[model samples]
Target: MGIKLLSIKNKFVAKCLLLTSTLALSGCDDWVVMSPFGDIAKQEAFLINASTVLMLVIVVPVLLMTVWFAWKYRASNKDATYEPGWHHSATLETVIWTTPLIIILVLSGLTYVATHRLDPYLPISRISEDKPLPDNVDTLVIEVVALDWKWLFIYPEYNIATVNEIAAPIDRPIQFKITSGSVMNSFYIPALAGQIYAMSGMETKMHAVINEKGVFDGFSANYSGHGFSQMHFKFHGVNDEGFDSWVSKVRSLDNQTLNHQGYLKLEEKTTGHPVTYFSTVGDNLYHDILNRCVDANTVCMDKQMHLDKHRAKNAVKHKE
Candidate 1:
């Protein structure tokens, strides 16, 4: 009988442990999947772990002491010490305050150094296990424009464009030049890199790389309009062969003309848009978009600057 009871207790403990481990690994969101981190991403994860542990070092002891004090000073415990004159202890005060202050100082120093060293716009230092980035590996340039409820990705190197789909070669550094067409938006790909803002009429840059081949979720972190929920894209990290195949497949499409009128029509609130390919785009189309002059005869930044100068000159003449 004793042996059977002991076996039951052991099985119960094992099941509890398994359940807790599973829940802890599941993570918060359903869309996020477990994937291996690259060099930079691993550093970010390490910082998070260090901060959490440092905070718990203070938090755990305080919580345990609170419970212990309550239990020891219970009304039923007649032997407990009760000294009304006992108030302040300089030694205890110094310890309680200085410990957290020191922790914060250490954390802040580490964060400051890491922030500048791992700035997303900075060039990557290491590629893999202690391997320096090779000079021959070309950095892929992707131009991203955030529209009302969709995303547009332009590959200038390949002279191709795709809507709601982004593909890149694994183990290659990617440079994203992002801007917004309408309002403010944030681009985030959790498993791959950090988040960066996309503002209208302004370009922001981010550098990231994917070491593993997989499909990751990318979404707009900022709420724009009514259709904000549908503004998402798929990030594909593929091998060289797969990337070549994708480019070829996109190039084979016949209807690749993206004229001014067609582009205007596409800037609407669209959900689940099929991947589009544009074989021929108008010259300086991206520059026009950046300057907010996609429409004909609209004043661009250069023209505005020229107008401001002319106004100042006229005022000077009038004063003279």
Candidate 2:
């Protein structure tokens, strides 16, 4: 009987080991790649991994100890030591508390350094360990306006613009200065980077570079109005030649110049917006949106600031 029970236990252990190995092997494919860490996207991923591992260092041991203690102290284990009133152990207490403190300190230091070093708004340092970004390589600046249910992408460098679709050259750094037309929203491209908020009358900048050529989906992560569900865009990372060709194709459009009236019409809530091209855009139009003065003679945040200052001065004079 004892031999039979031992044999069954051994078989069960072997089967469990085999199952665990198979799961671990399959998990490799699902494991998120942290390799492409040269960019901001990967940097954020690295931070996440670092914090998670640090936390797990404490969590795993505690879990194992809990299970071990429970089994070892079971009523069936007649040989186990037990003293109900013995709880305090100064040495054990110091070790348990100090070890976690050390882990926290290390984690906090890493987090603090990474937070500043991996700031999304910061420009790319070195493209790769082997190659440095050329000083003459001008950063591509795209002004993004989050509309009700669509995205407006304006490339000031090429003097061309597109709606609901954005294309950029692979391995080239791109900076997005984003703002919303009305309510607050979050700009997210999961395959590229994390989400960044877009608030009305405020411009938020994000830096990212796609190393591989692919089409990634971008959307509003924050819940806005009714049409927010359909608010989506395509991010294409192509070769430099392909990007140039795309620019030329967009430039060749007949009705590229989008006047103020046309812009207002385009800003309305729409669903599954077809890719539209603009050959020409109004001068400093993107700047106008960033300043929250897309409409004519409308009070902007800067103007409001001035008005508040003037009122304060007048109030001080009256008090005197």
- The whole-model lDDT of each prediction reads 0.83, 0.83
For 20-120, candidate 2 gives per-residue lDDT tens digits of 99988996763434444225667677788888998999999999999999999998999999799997999999989998999999998998898787677
Each candidate's TM vs. the true structure?
Answer: 0.85, 0.84
Error of 2 at 216 (Å): 1.3
- Candidate 1, residues 1-320, lDDT tens digits: the string is 99999999999999999999989767755533233455566667777778889989899999999999999999999999999999999999999999999999989988998899779888777676566788899999998889988888888888778888999998888899998888999988876777899998889988888887888778999999888898888988899999999888878876786666677777877776776778656666676677788888788766788999999999999999
**Model 1 / residue 96 / CA error / Å:** 0.8
